[model samples]
Target: MNWNQIEGNWKQFKGSAKAQWGDLTDNELTEAEGNRDKLVGKIQERYGIAQEEAERQVDSFAAGLKH
Candidate 1:
């Protein structure tokens, strides 16, 4: 799904996001609120990954979602 669609249906996708990144906390997800950059930052911080790697993972996650 596209980022706009994901942003629009963030609540519905929250579970999937949680499943994808188990290290993420509820507050972190809530803080992201479907913003790709915010989510990437949270993931980077939690996973100790590079921003580029986090972005790649988040992009892959979004691509895997059903429209």
Candidate 2:
């Protein structure tokens, strides 16, 4: 999904995000302010992954939801 969709559905999406990346805390998710880029950046920072890797992971996780 795009940023708008992710922002609109953050409540539902957050659970899956947390499940996918257990390192993130509820506070961080809340503080991300529904911004996909910011959320991904936080994930990248917290997990020490490269931007491309973080994006790939997020994309993969999002794609899995379609199934």
Candidate 3:
């Protein structure tokens, strides 16, 4: 799904995001507030992954929501 759709429907999809990234706390996700950049940064920080990998994962996660 697109960022607009994701942002608009953040509440519904955040559970799935939590499932995918269990290291992230509830407050972190809430802080992200459906912003892609915020999510990427959080994932990167929490997972100790490279920024590109975080973006790739976020892209995959967003794409999965479309199906």
Provide the TM-score for each candidate, comma-separated: 0.97, 0.84, 0.96
Model 2 misplaced regions, further than 4 Å: none
Off by over 4 Å in 1: none
lDDT of 3 by residue, 1-67 (tens): 9999999999998999999999999999999999999999999999999999999999999989953
Give candidate 3's whole-model lDDT: 0.95
What is candidate 2's lDDT per residue for 1-67, written digit by digit as tens? 5767777878878888888889999998887766868888999999999999988887787667641
Report the alpha-carbon TM-score of model 1 versus the true structure.
Answer: 0.97
Backbone Cα, N, C clashes tallied per candidate: 0, 0, 0
Candidate scoring better on TM-score of 2 and 3:
3
The number of residue pairs in model 2 that clash at the backbone is 0
Ranked by TM-score, top first: 1, 3, 2
Candidate 1 RMSD to the real structure? 0.6
